[model samples]
Target: MSLDLPDLRTDLETLAEAHGITGAVVAFAAGDEVAEAATGVLNSRTGHPATTGSLFQIGSVAKAWTATLVMQLVDEGRLDLDQSAQSVLPGLALPDPVTIRQLLAHTGGFEGDVFVDTGRGDDAIEKLVALLGEVPRLSPPGAVWSYNNAGYVVLGRVVEVLRGVPYNQALRTHLIGPLGLTRTATSADEAILYSTAVGHAGGEPVPTWSLMRSNDPAGSSLAMTARDLLTFARAHLSDGAGVLPARLARMMREPQVTLPDLGRPSRWGLGWELQEWAGGTVVGHDGSTPGQAAVLKLVPEAGVAAVLLTNGGDPDPLVAELVAPVLSRIAGVVPPAPPTPPDPPLPFVVERYAGRYVSDVMAWEVAGDDEGRLWVTVTPLGAMAAHGGSQTFELVRLRQDTFVFAQARGGVHSAVAFLGEGERARYLHTGRLNVRRSL
Candidate 1:
């Protein structure tokens, strides 16, 4: 499994160019053998080169780190996964009871995408948690699986209350510090001290460098080099080197809930996304920030792990081009092919899916024309509107209640699904669950 470092760097540069990736870091490990490579620029404006030690925004992948810290508390018998989230934080108001495990598994059911900038104080997460009372409960707790950013913030608060420290400090003290990751950055300010990659969009630098401090638990400001990311991944592979308990690490990879195939994970572990590849199982997570994206994939059965970090351009193809070969050679793993549209678009039962789905941050409408053509319109609202403007997508049936975007946008053929029965969709699932016509 030993790698030729020079060849890997050359190959990575070639693949990045092929995929239009402006800059990236690629790292892979097979037990004793490890190789890391970097290519392109940190910022298009500055033209700083991406290097082996360069940090890129890891985004929601920080959720995995947050979850690991929570698991450390669980390992010490300080917190029970089944305990109600409200019970841990005495005055925390929840519409319905939500368990610690529910928050970790994203089954907490409350409006989970509540990203508000409380401030740059240690009390930021506490402030965001206090505002959860105003957030509506989308579904009964533990009844569904939705990607919940707000839920992670709540988990961060749980860590804060239990560990008796701020969320960012707790992460460093527990996970980051314990793993001996010298290059991991807990905040954007800290990341700037290192050679950090700035996020870019459409081949240009993104105006904003970071999100609000309140969202730190959900990975708003965390950044790390690919090699450091691999080191963290290795902790799971090697029992956390006296930090994370082996049982908890194994438990994190154990499937807690099955997810509807929307072109990503097949199941959800405590904090990890579990994908079933042809070779075996790959437990991992993916991240996306303003203009940066990252992915951490691990094949524990093969004693193999890999990380891809990118700033700007089309990274999806770069991921496939760069990650698959190393994984395949080491573990005989094959990623599921990206879902493609049928040669002739298949017809769907319009009544089953045509409905308006609404959430606090985004609204979506599915409609069918007289010719039975399907279309989806999305409007970002309030705080979320700043990220993007409205856009319409043409969809073709993939299966019951599921449709794939007729064309790939941002190098992904995004899938959208409706949940319900008979004639009408009761919910819309595009990662986060949106209720039908519920405001």
Candidate 2:
């Protein structure tokens, strides 16, 4: 079978221009053949031309890398997945006894988006663990599936404890250097040495480079070129083997916890996301920073992997229009399409989903009108409000206890999945779990 490459540079330029994106890179690998291309500017103000080799923030995709390192320790008999995190990291306190495995699977059942800056000192992650003592626990450990950032932060601190070094250094020594990813950067100082893309949110270059350093393990400062990212993705292909043990690499793609039905990955693996797509299994993750976004999908059966990294704007349309076709042609793998509103929304009982769902930094106030239609008013709070303001959205029921944005916001059909039983839903799952205040 022959694999041909597309005109990726032209495709990216056209898509980036149409989507209001500052810049982007697209790269993929099938067997040993690889292709990559980039378009637009690194920063609008500087007018630097984006290149295939330029690094862009890879966001939570870094979580997969952190997870890989933890597995590496496991392979060496140095760490155990089921070991309680509090066992290794002595000053750590949690409402429930969380295990390393639960943290990896994001079933630790805590408010995972805690993003307090703990300074750039070597002890930043350690200080982060100290603060986790007071964070809100969404459920008993290992009881629920919530997308967790703080859990990875704690995992990063664990890596530091075991490796006897900061997370960044451990990445280089264990993974980056071994994988030969020369373009990957773990810090702003390192990123400056390469042609790196800065984020542009709302078509304007962001004032800051990356988020707080304390959350580095949860993908705050990691940046890399699309080619470099695909290089990392290649390591996880089912048949591929090298630095990581073949057994653990295969385990990372196995489903750990099922995700809520909200047009996201269907299940969570040890460190990666697993989705059943078009009769094939796709393993990967999506990530976003202040103004950048990235996605990776690998059809393990076909031995093919693809990634799209963007500086700003929604990549949904671009991904569906461009990236999907490439995977389909080689592997017959088409990503799940964005959910659409029913011609007439299935008749919904408003009281079931209507109420205030609150998280640490965001809220959704769902209410019903006299016409028996449902709507939502989203209020971004604290640091989230600083980046974007709140807006109202009409709700369209897609399924039982699940609703989608009536109007596509950012070219993506966003959604909310209300979980638990009874008339009043106990929690709202929107990528992250937001608890119901009125429950």
Model 2 CA lDDT for position 12: 76
Instruction: Note the residue pairs that clash in candidate 2.
Output: none
lDDT accuracy of residue 343 in candidate 2: 92
What is the C-alpha lDDT profile of model 1 across 236-311, one tens digit per residue?
8885655787888999999888886686558899999999888899988898889899999999888889999999
* Position 127, candidate 2: lDDT: 89
Candidate 1 Cα errors over 4 Å, as ranges: 4-6
Assess the local accuracy of residue 408 in candidate 1 as a C-alpha lDDT between 0 and 100: 89
State the lDDT of candidate 2 residue by residue for 95-160, as single tens digits. Answer: 888999999999999889888898988888888889999888788887778999999999999999
- lDDT of each candidate versus the true structure: 0.87, 0.87
* Cα RMSD, each candidate: 1.6, 1.4
